[model samples]
Target: MKEESQTIRTKLAKIRFFSPEGFFVCAAIITVIFVAMEALGLRSSVAVLAGASPGAGAPATLGMACLYLLGYLAFVVLAPIFVMGSIFLLLVNLITGIFRRQQRHF
Candidate 1:
């Protein structure tokens, strides 16, 4: 059990997510979606959340509102996390590689 805990899990660490490339992709996708929704005037549709409608199909308005809200949340939350994670992972990998290379020469 002790040895198992001490052993590094290289497979999990090798996952492509949260890498510099992945983060940039994630942030770009999220920003695109948020901008698209904003450009479509979806923010006004979110008034459905307050039980107010533009006197049209209530279901459609509600759906658009929910989508906008979700996109907004993702933009506000996940985008920053991905950006920070990518930067941190890149720096850590760079520093570690430098250290390992020096140690190998020594």
Candidate 2:
């Protein structure tokens, strides 16, 4: 029972997202997505009024445009910001952990 408990604890301790490196890797992935979206020129596809509307398929176009806009915003802005915040949180956790360990040692 004690060995099982120790193994469980060790597995939990090794979880990747608990560390700063994991957050940095996630941020890099989000940055790549943002760049890809910008390069694809899909960002401006959401401008509904900038071009003449289709005579019969306006609704379909509008729906697709909204979807594209949502995806663009998600990958271009929200995902990167969320990843950056995660990285910041990871850094804070690391710094506090270091300080707490030093305090315990002293």
User: How does model 2 score by TM-score?
Assistant: 0.54
| TM-scores of all predicted structures | 0.78, 0.54
> Local distance difference test, per candidate?
0.83, 0.67
Candidate 2 positional error at 84, Å = 1.0
Worst 10 residues of 1 by lDDT: 6-15
Structure candidate 1, residue pairs in collision: none
Residue lDDT tens for model 1, 2-93: 66654544444555664786786788789999999999899999777776777445788888888999999999999898888889889999
In model 1, the Cα lDDT at residue 22 comes to 72
Scored by Cα lDDT, where does model 1 land?
Answer: 0.83
Model 1 TM = 0.78
Pairs that clash in candidate 2: none
